[model samples]
Target: MIHFFKQDVSHIALPEKFTYPFHYTPHPLCVLATGEVKEYIAGKKEWQEELATGKMFGVLVVQMPQSTDTGYLAAFSGNLAGKNIHSFFVPPVYDLLQPQGFFKIEEEQISAINQRIDELENSASYLKAKERQKVETAKAQATLNQAKAGLKAAKEARELRRQSSLALSEEEQAGLIRESQYQKAEYKRLEKEWKRQVEELEAEVTRFESEIERMKMERKERSAALQERLFEQFRMLNAKGEVKDLCTIFEETVHKLPPGGAGECALPKLLQYAYFHQLKPLAMAEFWWGDSPKNEVRHHGYYYPSCKGKCEPILQHMLQGLEVDDNPLLDNLHKDTKLEIVFEDEWLLVVNKPAGMLSVPGKADEVDSVYHHLKKLYPNATGPMIVHRLDMATSGLLLVAKTKEVHQHLQEQFEKRSIRKRYVALLDGSLSDIEKTGRISLPLCLNPLDRPRQMVSEEYGKEAITDYQIISVSNGHTRIAFFPLTGRTHQLRMHAAHPKGLGCPIAGDELYGKKAGRLYLHAEYIEFRHPIYGDIICIQKEAEF
Candidate 1:
């Protein structure tokens, strides 16, 4: 059985139930473990050295049944020598240090093969061959140029002879003609020879390229086979002594092969250790500790949910008989609200959208959206009525086109940036005097591991700009008005949350800030020219909050 770390937690309030593994606030045990790990790392000289390199470390709080108390185990996602070897933490999912392991051998062999291929590509003989081809091409071009010059000279000579034919003998004229014919024949012969040489040189280069391609394909095949062997060795076992390889588990559950970083999480390591030791699983949580990655938002000492893309499928199989909470985010919350139409015309309609309703039908079958509701209300609507979309948590004025032509026109306006919009949000914290009015220029991209979550990442993100001014400030919160210059997924939420932008997330943003009753963002105003009417139309709706 796993041993629990002894600490005075008499005042700490333990959660009565486990957190929904998909998303929830971290349990008290997990938070305590995070604090302990932070303290431990700060005191260690080796850990300080490792932290300087920006390595990510994670901790998992688990309950061991045999110990009659909840304990925590820590592990790095990839590797950290000082942390991994610590007795207080669980062992790695796979120890890569074993010198005679098949993984190590396959890795070394593949590395050697890649090195050999690189050497062959840059060898002296290969470079010399390329230079020789270049020299031959230059010589052929020179010969072609000479042939053209000779042809031109022969034509000029023939023309002069023809003009002087009356003053010259027939023999001289015939000789001149013969010389011209000879030059033409020589030019044709030179052209043919040049073509032949060029073709031969091209064929030689093709052969060299083909040989290199063949070598690469051969190496790829070997590497693929080795990788398959490595994956097959990653077989996991359950408490019942039944075993299944990681590939089979993912395929049977998610109907696809396991993706990269599938079995490299803290949960897999902790669960595997529990199964082997016959310890009943009680609760588990994972937290991020270290520098945030360049492309993802991860603050040190923050608790994060397990990734959906990589871990969900694996955990579905691993936690076969264990009871878990249904994901609350998947529930349809738009059933009660009716579509509020603000304005209607022959060509278009503008409606007030409610928060918690989808802009369109999502992947889930039970989802109720503004588009689907409009289809029911206007059964004879000619085209896709929803011209644009607001985030599910944002309430606002939405434009709808009745005909395909009107839809196209409005879409064109949006693309041209002629349509104007304004949003209102209550931020969690106050802004300084200079920050009362400003624009935020930050790039954003989706966090693949956690769906719908946007992070500030300049390297791989799209440009998202937001203009804002303080509307009011009271009770440790500031109500701000926003003008979005560019549209991107979760642009406002991320901009509000990013430290470089506002340094405070919009209130009730579960992904970036603390969770509340609902997100405090509302699209309050919109203005655009009518497609058929040629008159400008403006609409406004007040937020219920």
Candidate 2:
């Protein structure tokens, strides 16, 4: 059974509702740890320099037993030096910093090899070889130019002979033609020689490059050998002294390659420390303690989930012997709630989607979706029933087509920008009148390492535009209406939270902002042309707060 520690009955206030610990405010213990980290940073001159440049620090709250009372210990995630060294916090699940570790030795050797490769590229022999090729190319060009000149002169002579038909004999004209032929042959000969010389030079350059690549490959093999040894050494021990290395754990469980940043989170650190010290594991929470990263949204003090790509597999193996709580976020809160069908016809159907229900089935276990329910209700429904989708946390109007023909027609309308959609949202911060109404044009794409989470990426993202107007502002929150022009994933959420756009996340946005009861984003209005009736169809729904 999962275990939770009982807080001391001393009038110490705790959150009345259970905050999803994975992505929530720092626990009091974690806050105290942050204070300690702050003091530690202030005392060290080196840490001050890193702090000035901006860095994200985190603290994990764990429970330990004491004679008088249950005590709490706060473990910082990673190191303050940003070098990821072993610290007061739990050692990394994989000790990449072990003295004389294969990883360390190979990493240094690789650096030296890279330096040698760079030097080879800039060496006198390499430079001279390149220079020789250049000179050969120039000589080839000069020879080709001379041949072309001779050919041109011969052509001119032939033209002069043809024009002087009355002055020159047939033999003389034939002789001129012969001379032109000879010049053409000489040009061909020179061209062939130039080609041969260039090919030989290219072959020489290829040989030189091949030799360099071979050397680099040899060094890389050495590095790979060391990495294999290091991976073998990455073993973790639990409180019961049962040990499992990373390679075995990953191979047996995830059956995939370990992702970057694996074994580099607060959970691994906290768990390792708890097991080593024989502390009884209790409630745990991790919270950000410093500046937000430029590329990602990380509010200072906001709790975040351990990254799924990296930590999911590792945590799965590490938490095998521990009694852990089921992730509250995965619970389907809207399982009992039915899809509210607002409008339906022979050709199409429209429904008012709830905040927590998915537009369609996702994972195999996630069979509760509007599309799945609708398919069961209308078994004859053809093609894709879901014409468009709203985010799982976003509530409101959704379009559904009953037939393939109807779906195609509606999809065409969407592609042509003929369908209109308006959303209502509550922003976390107030906006001035000038900032109240404007178009937010930001590009968005998925954060590759973190799936499903979208970020504003200028270079790699698709265009996402939203025209917004503030409806009302009270108690530091702005109620805004959004008219989206482009249908990109998470366009409205990212636009609302991006610094260049509104600079405030929609109220209750868990991924882009702090978590609340529900995401305030609601699809309040939609308009499109009916496929069969040929009349314009409009739908609107009010948000339930």
Candidate 3:
């Protein structure tokens, strides 16, 4: 259910007409609401009346089950299903004290007032009894004094009679006895009054005994609440439960601190918890959670700096299957081409690829390509590695390493620009200078709209270099020997298609230059240090163009 009951409409105001292009938009107070409303749009009839009368009401539109902040119902609308709902309506702000958070607080105050009234009534009765006991004490003291005086007189009379030595009268002796009895009775009454006073004091103490117990319990509960708040703050900072030494810290330090009227105790615990969690050092006593209160990581001075920026995701995806053992190319190569094992050794294998075949499986499904074909050809190889890639449309020499150690050695050579690779490609342009070579240095990056295509970018691009020499010009096309200094995706196509360079696209490159049935570019040569032989090995293939 959507909880929209606590919200108020006065806090939300509609913009002046013509300020907003849209007739209605989401209301801001949807977060503080209680009732669920399905398909409730903003700008309702009630909202228009409230806005016109310059009054606000608590209103919200909520999604059911989730109570999501999907939209908000406001008090303004131009029309309803069939009537102009905004025409005959007036907002009543003061008359309507709809049940809200303030209502709850007022109810709590009323309850407290009623409790205070009961306490006052009980206190008044107790005070009246105390006053009555004081009056009784005064009366009892006066009576006891009178009785003592009378007893003194009777004792004197009896002494006089004994001195006279004449036969003492029985009636006089009896009188003395009676006076003695009266004194005794008065003393008893006084004792009774004193006892009554003691009983009344005890009764009064019993009345307040529960108050003392309540105060003690309240202190205990406040202490527990303070600890809980601290623990919650600690969890927020650490992003996990049970920080180290936290329980001991609360036991030794938090418990000893005074709770200033129950509420102040949570502050110290919160501060100390932040200190222990490394969000703020113990030396810093004060800290703010910041405008974004949910971000404890920021408050604790932690940051995650982006490494590769936009390219990071793409690179991560490329490396996902880099370490996997499966090689799909072996199982899905085109039927027209078959792999030819050129040379084999303990740690390496060389293969000759046919034209119209990929060096590795495409990212799409369907493998059985050259890399997997090599793996299947030598099932005992530790980890088949492609030292270089031959474009699917171009084919020639391809190298693979059997072990990771050998693969790294060859990869490092390629990275350091120590390995030499040469390719021959037929271009659509004729060359005026024979055996003339030139270098093309340009930055390369992927085209934004068509990411599969590469583009030349002077800004925010990687530097690429290529060298080319004219081989033969015949049939309005020039065959050239190409050497690349930097390996980049589609670097050769870019170099050959440049206006100042060959000015002719690779023969079969439909993406760059004149389209043909097949690409003429071939992997003609590769030279690198042998992993086991400790010798400089150079492999070459005849020019395909």
Candidate 4:
């Protein structure tokens, strides 16, 4: 699967360390290799339409041992064109799709179980038994009801006869009471008989269902066991030649079990082959080559980091014993940015937060944040000084409270949605068909696999609404104003990039759009009530871009 480099690259310097897979700037060699792979895919017109649906491909630049030959390996996530054994791309760690593999053999048995379940569910005998049970139960209930009604009428008649007999003789009254007692005894007998009939009918139905239930239980157990065994077969390799299966690797992580499709990603396949063949890996990169997914924001040919949920633990094991670059997330992104105070009073202040600055202290031993800055400025400020937050990539106006009481009041206003916010952003693409004004109501939730990234999810997302007005369209870019009625994380970004909404990503939005000098979104205006003064207040800041 090694394709030797055709272009001369002797002048380019090699990286001092391996590219960190989780987050990276693609190396020059990797970029060259990715371009070649893309060219090959493009020439294959047979796969063009299917591949236009979207796929992830990766390249691993490796050095052949004791030789000057420098070639790269290519891999695609999962299978291409329904097969994992395609030429040029590396094979999977364990080909579960192989016809003779244990996974397939077990899968057939599971399929049989499923078929049997369907047969039993639709069997004539089972259906007939169910129908009979329903009908018989209804008949039994109706009989009991009719008997009770007859007994009630008989009692009424007995009472009338006794009342008339009171003027005649005591024996007559005694006879009427005896008749009432006999009628009650008959109703009791009929009720018991009907209950017995209903029980028999229910038992008949249970007899037909018992086998199907047992088969379903067996299917569940066998499927779970088969999946665990499949994980065991996927043994991974590290640069040191150490090995760990999927189960063992995931057990060491916070998620104690491997997620589905854990070992099939392009990153894992590339490294697995590199280690298996004794090649020394120097650099790697993964890029999306086709259509962007519905929920995520992806640009064609743009390089992206490996996912966290599936690849993080696997990469942690596979990358051992190699000199890798430190994670960039731990570094401060806005060390030179300074917070600008926009408005201030006895209780609170509004500051213009620069893009890339954190609203509060973050993990990875980062202590520089707006909250910490306020602490240094006020020194004696009480409670949490930071009243609200903005995405690190977004420049915005943030409210800061000086006292605990004031913070509570501001929080209450936010909860009641009395605080109004307006943002201005420049989209990377022009929206020729978009109306001048509109409302976008796409729901959003954090992508479980990728932290801090939001996705459009109608099923589990919280309601996020934005009203937008197109400001101007110029040079293939659209500038718009966003009035957010909800403050979910990344709500505005998701609404803008999602295909069902604006279908355009904001300029320089590294997570959703092409990376540039900075994100082109800004909180330009806000209106709120003063917490202490009980007076309406408004603030405005012009975007630098």
Candidate 5:
């Protein structure tokens, strides 16, 4: 559905190209559209609680048909209130929820199969076979044990006869040997008879198991086919009027199959309707509308980028023939910035690394890193001069080793947690709920769906602990000092943003919070025992922020 702007947006200049979707600043028109969509959501009081539990909504600012006016289209990702169709929003690319749809029919078939499988597993015949097998196995073992005991008693009696003092003929000794051989043969026969009886019960159980396995295999195949067919239904359109389904788009990508919830996101839906109805897309923005996810950090009403795992391949095709903004991540901003050395010695040195530079060189062509800069300074430095790493956006002290031996020694200290680290950060929100000083113990792990981004996952995460003390509070922002007891990827950021911890993300944290001019986190202090000098080594640097 197309909704025209109620207020005057004529003074705002239109964007030259569409929003990049992955990383962008919303255009003035897109911002206005976002505000209007928010008001509409608020007007629906019935949906308030559901919306508060987290949902992603997107808006696309478009040029309406045959009119010199600009308007927008709104959509919610996936479904809302157990339904896909709703008022004032674009319809799904493929509505699997429709009663007469093939997806629904096939889904019911699958459900029926599942129910049948359950029935067979719990059937009296199958259960009887399993019980028979168990009872037969135990009887077999007991019979074999009794037969062995009888044979051992017979052998002992034969040994007693041989040990007697009476002088016996060679024929008597031969008779005793023959008796032992006959007894052994009888035991072998008994063992075989019991084995045959036990095997019959096992065979009956195996027959039932084989049928269950066959049904399970069938279930898996049908599920795969249904998923593929569902993906084929999502035929998306581009500005050039080109159409492609989810399967074809993802087949061209590294992942040859569409991920779950691929074509249902708000961005894809909004673009699909715009292209089908001949609306010219100007810019677009997606935002979180409710509570943060359990494992991820998302603030209410905050703008977010379209997820890469699902939408990247689809949007790559949909945005064709439309000019889009340049990706800001690829910008090489370290050309003129200087890498400053704060402390130096023959064994090691400390450098003040600037923000927006990688700790180590990445795959990018022009991006500079602290490791490369350090290597340039110490041309003959031995064995991977960089000792530790900091997040690219974090600015401050970085320890570097001049020799391989020193590097190894320093690395041991880090592994043993002998090194003390302190960081200064500015949290976007005030710390009214938490104490002035406290410890945050939230486990962390990488978010595989969104690489380089970390999440708090108690189920599959490593121990990440941080002790913090508030330095000051002003302008609704809290300046804090963090003392990390364990080194983990994005430990500080996850602790700050996670609901179980401070519940306030670090200021300008693009991965966890809002994107700003720079991330307001700095590695300010480090302490360790010198590898060669056998003395306490301490270094501290102040943050520019």
Candidate 6:
């Protein structure tokens, strides 16, 4: 049963079998255990109309009976002056109608609701328009910037061409020459800027092409589509269509580009194309041929350079290398240590290698290396043999053999896994498992996507095992002792940082861990059988932590 009034707990007894209609929200109101009595605030027109029989602003008291489920519906039909007020007792009813006054209140409520909806719609529209405008504004700005650069370049180029023309009178020609030189300087500056832009574009293209090649080899159609989408924007910039003649156009455009002209050098453009195509073989050949070579051919066995004496002229005139040869890398490493020996003996030598020092010589920069250092130290020897390697960053315990026989013996021991190597590492997070010891059996494989990162894979991977124990923990850092079963490049370090394992990345491993500093892992101990003495030998150095 439903009752309507204002603020009373008492109920008058009423009969049943009567019904009335009422409007209500579908949401249920929580009925207090003690029963709540309140004025029925109606927002529906039918409810308001029912309540309007009485004065509009007067209060209606309600009673929620404590003893029964059904209660009386009474109407006190006049003001409190006792002016012929009518009293009525209605039977218990479930559907009650609203008074006329309540109906009017509902109509106004609906109008307010509609206004709110309109406001919300306007707000939504405004936000959408603002976002669209922002996007368009950014696009317009970018377009303007590009146009400005192109126009400036074109204007400068035209001016230079005009000045270079010989049709002007002598006085005018002198003025033109002066103007041309100034413009030429400006053009060179612009050319440098253009070169920088081209380099950036080339790098971007190279990365894109590398990704594409990787995707193609894996037969990833979706990846290829994504790659094409990224290139679409680039194609618009370059005014390119289809992939055919792309290299040729790029090369020609770059080549025809004068030093300060509106055009760019073709070398970068060609390199970018070759990088994208992974035409490394051809690219390498071109690079080896230097900037210019009159005649060059790659045959089955070797490369042939028949320059028609053009190469000699280039070497003499263009390169200016007649008196001295300059290698920039060597120039960068021009120090006494590059020539001085760290440690040398007739049998073996150890070197304190500075960073950027190669343990052995590469094909190109074959001048400065440990071999060079050793060669300089031992003039009578043929070539020093590198027994093991410490990466350019690692600065201690590099072993080299002077005699071929000794080198072969030392190499055999390393290859046979007869060396006991220990590394000290400062790792991320405090050591939780200081006494715990277990073998990490995850197989290691070089990352196909990023060659520099090694991944743990289940298939097509080689077995890698590292035994690590926490030595000490301090300052949220754990010093760990590492021993490897297999000598994989970056094996122990990679395994330690694996998320499922300890999750404590080695300090100084910027690629694998938070950039704390340099790589904190140091090879502090190496034990092996000595070649000359038929006994085991151990070498240890103080921690460089």
- Which digits, one per residue and each the tens of the lDDT, describe model 1 over residues 1-545? 24455687656765555456777766666666777777777787766656654544555555565565666666656566633345756776666546788867877887887887788788787777777778988998898898898789778877877896677778877888788788878888888988888788778777777777887887799877765665566667654567777778776653466666566677777777777766666566666656655555555555567777777766766676555555666778777678889889888998888878888888885888998888888888888889999888778889999888999999999989899999999998776555678999999888766676777777888988899988998888989999998889988888787767776778887666666788999988889999987899998888887
TM-score of 6: 0.40
- The C-alpha stretches of model 2 lying farther than 4 A from their native spots are 1-49, 52-69, 73-78, 82-88, 94-101, 123-139, 145-185, 192-208, 237-242, 252-255, 364-367
Ranking by TM-score: 4, 5, 2, 1, 6, 3
Which pairs, if any, clash in model 5? none
lDDT of 6 at 45: 42
Q: Which stretches of candidate 4 lie over 4 Å from their true place?
A: 156-170, 335-337
lDDT value, candidate 3, whole model: 0.51
lDDT digits (tens) for residues 215-279 of candidate 2: 79978798767656665665666545677665666675444545444556666666666667766
Using all chains and alpha carbons, the TM-scores for the candidates as numbered come to: 0.81, 0.83, 0.39, 0.94, 0.93, 0.40
Give a tens-digit lDDT track for model 5, residues 1-545: 99989899889988999999998888888888899999999899989999999999999999987886889999999998888999889999889999999988999998988998899899999999888889889988988899899989998888788787386679998888888899899889888888888888889888888888998899899999999999999999998999999999999877799988999999999999999898989999998888998989888888889888888889999999899998877788886677899999988999999988888888885788888777778899998888899988899889999999999999999999999999999999998767999999988888866667788887989999999999999999999999999989988988998888899999998777888888999999999999998899899999988
The local lDDT score (0 to 100) that residue 363 gets in candidate 4 is 82
Q: Write the per-residue lDDT of candidate 3 for residues 1-545, one digit (tens) a residue.
A: 11234444555542222111011122333323212221232335444433332211223232223332233222211223332222212122111123553433554554565565457446866567566656766766676677667767877876887788677688876876787777678778767877777677657755655564565565566546644544333221221222322333334432433222121121222222322332321110111111211101111111111112222222122223112222222444475456776667788877777776777767753644687676666676665488878767677778799887898888888899998888888886677754487888877887543344566777866989998888778888887888999988878887776554455678766445433667778887888889778788888878644
- Candidate 1 is scored at a TM of 0.81
Q: Rate the local accuracy (lDDT) of all candidates.
A: 0.75, 0.73, 0.51, 0.88, 0.90, 0.46
Which pairs clash inside model 2? none
Candidate 4's residue-wise lDDT over 1-545, tens digit each?
99987789887788889999876778899989999999988998988887888888999999898876678999999888888888879999999989998999999999999999999899998899899889988898888889888988887877777676548477776777778788888888888888887888788888778888999999999998998999999899999899999999999978798988989999999999999998889999988877888878777887888888899899999999899998866668666557799999888999999887778888854646788778878999999888889987789899899999999999999999999999999999998786999999988898988776888887998999999999999999999999999999988888888778888989887677677778899999988899877999999999998
Write one digit per residue (lDDT tens) for candidate 6, span 175-266.
75676567657656765665565555556445545544554444444434433332232221111212322222223332321111111111
Worst 10 residues of 4 by lDDT: 328-337
Residue-level lDDT for 22 in candidate 4: 75
lDDT against true structure, model 1 = 0.75
Candidate 1 wrongly placed segments (more than 4 Å):
1-19, 49-61, 66-68, 81-86, 163-181, 184-215, 237-242, 249-257, 338-352, 372-382, 401-408, 427-450, 453-464, 469-479, 497-505, 542-545
Worst 10 residues of 5 by lDDT: 160-169
